[model samples]
Target: MPFTGKSGKFNAAIRTVEIGTGDKAVKLGGENVLPFYTFDAPIENAPKIGVLITDMGLENEVAGIKDYYAGATTFAEIAKKAEEMPGADFVVLRFEGADPNGENRSVEDCVAIAKEVGDAITAPLVIEGCKNVEKDAELFSKVAEALQGKNVLILSAREENYKAVAAAAGLAYGQKVGAESAVDINLAKQLNVLIGQLGVDQANVVMNVGSAAAGYGFEYVVSTMDRVKAAALAQGDVQLQMPIMTPVADEAWNVKEAMASEADMPEWGSQEERGIDMEVETAAAVLASGSNAVILKHPTSVATISKLIKALV
Candidate 1:
């Protein structure tokens, strides 16, 4: 008798969330099995990667990154350089300049830059605010209106600002909404439910469920994602079935291991190498554990993770 394998495919599948438009548009989720479990079931989408660029600019970036985008002075030019990086699936525009406690940039300035990048790139765009609840509430709404027909994905409509973001970006202008939550399964599900109640289709909502550097309490990140996927697939939890998009660049690069200078800790080797390692490690772990998309900073990290996903899926 021939050996037989148990079917691991679940009855329910993760919802597909589409961002952007035309040929460059990317689809996330649409799998009924665990990540990379192609033997169980073929994945409808092979995950996706976004290159993250801050509005403030990448002045202190590593040599490799600097070399890749050499002479790209403007925001639109820089974003185009990022999107052209090998294996990049989209562009994530982070509004660090719009933070009230920091740059305190006005809504008009933010909207101007957003339109520049939005118009410049044919690739899908994801707009993430500066994490201030009030600022993001206004910033996301204004930017959403600015990039109306572009159909961008507004990252992170948290409990605090989901109402404004979901109503304007999602319902009115018809863009994808990212329902963000802290790294808790219940919190994520609840936020998703609330966003859905506002009439944003599940297919148009992606979850920014939170993340941390690898080994820096990232066990919580791993477990939370695993639980979300299991419930969504095996338990048929509709509210938890939205595709997950983790922003890995900030957390991974800001960690002590990635930031420590080679002069300070010779044993840690090059600072650039450490940062790439952290980004790649955290991203790979999250994808395997269940993220449908990831935002990475370094060009090398994005290329490496892109290859990893391509090889695995």
Candidate 2:
């Protein structure tokens, strides 16, 4: 008898979720096997890259990312830069100024900026909240109402604020919501269940299984995501089947390796190159772990990661 290798089989496939509408929409997830496992099963859609834009403008951005928007002054300009970038599939409008302890910008101000950017770019927008749970719930609610039916992805709904954000996303706006959890697979699954119970369709929910920088507990993130996907596929868990999203840029840029200057550590090499590599390497790791979309900063990393994905899938 001739020797033959056993064929691999998967019980469930990742759910496909659509963001935006009409000709500009993008599909995420929809894979029957693990990330880049094309030899085992066909991939329905390639992973996507979402460029991060902020309401605070480039002056408030980290030094490493400021050059990308030199002379740009408005949200419209930022959207234009993202659209022109080679691999940008969507835009993330982070309302950093909405933090109550920070600028404490009004909800009206944040909504105005979101509307401006949404109208400026045809690419789908992910309207991210300031990390303040209470403030984000109220702020996101108003924003969702204003942008109803535009097909935006609201980021996100946590244990403390899932009810308000989920209701805004599914009931008020008919949009999608990102359900976030700490780096625990069970917590992630529970949040997804809670979001669904709030009347948001499971298909409209995306899982943000938590993110960590390259040298800072990134392995934990990988393991959590792996387990989440495994439960969705091998264990036949529907609530855990939503696509995974990782906001890599925020975590990657905040780390010492990405933020430290050459003067601080000459042996570490150029800060610019190190920062770009940090973002690129972190994003690559997350994608390889079955993330369907990654929110990124810096055009250099975006282009590099895009090329890497092309060679991969």
Candidate 3:
């Protein structure tokens, strides 16, 4: 018998979630095999890269990020430039100011900024909240309503606030909802279950199953993603079949290794270089572990990862 290669494709595929509209819309998931395993079967949609910008407008941006934007100072200017980044498939507008503990920015103010960014850029939009459950519930709902037809993905609907966010974003506004859970397979599935029970279409849900910087006990993150992908394809797990999108910027750049200045930790090399390295490594790790999309803040990281994806897939 002639030697033959066995195909590893599975019967089930990750559900396709489309954000944005018209020609600029991007698709996530929709592949039957494992990540980057095109040899097994054709990956229906290539993984996506999203550049994250906060409403803070890059005030304290690192040297690299500052240089990238140059004279673009306003939120709208930053967003437009981000949309035009080398490999940015979409732009994430994080409303960090909405955190009641910090800036205590009001919902109205955040909404105004969201609308401004929404109107300014044609690229797909993703709304990242300030992580305050109560504030996010209100902020996300209002932003969802504000960006109604933009088909944005609210990041995200947690256990405590799922009802309000999911209902408003997925049901009322006709946008996508992100079901976020800690780095646990069971938690991820349960949130998806809860979201599904809300009458939201499964196709409209994406998973943000938590993330961590590489080398920061990241094994757990990798294992969690690995199991989710395995169960989705091999075990036909519908609840776990949603595409995974990990936010790598906040987690990677905040780690002490990335944040420590060269003066404080001269052995760590350049602080900016360290931050970018952590981000790129973590994003690449998650992608290989089955993430369909990864959010990054550095232009070099985005360009590098984009080239890697192109070469691999």
RMSD of each: 0.9, 1.4, 0.8
- Candidate 2, after superposition: displacement of residue 173 in Å? 1.3
Per-candidate TM vs. native?
A: 0.98, 0.96, 0.99
lDDT of 2 by residue, 1-313 (tens): 9998654458788899999877878998998788888778778799999999888888756565687777777889888788778899999999999999999999999989988888888888898989999999999898888888789999889999999999987777798899989999999989988888878889898989899988798889989888988888888899889999899989988888977889999999988788788899999999999899999989889999999888888
lDDT string for model 3 (57-109, tens) is 88777999999999997889999999999999999999888888889899999
Q: Name the 10 consecutive residues with the lowest summed lDDT in model 2.
A: 4-13
Model 2 accuracy (lDDT, Cα): 0.88
- For candidate 1, lDDT tens digit of each residue in 160-207? 999999999999899999999999999999999999998888889999
Report the candidate with higher TM-score, 1 versus 3. 3
lDDT of each: 0.93, 0.88, 0.95
Error of 2 at 72 (Å): 2.4
TM-score computed on alpha carbons, candidate 2: 0.96
Write down the lDDT that model 3 would get: 0.95
Q: Which ten residues in a row are the worst by lDDT in model 1?
A: 55-64
Highest lDDT: which candidate? 3
Candidate topping TM-score: 3
lDDT of 1 at 175: 92
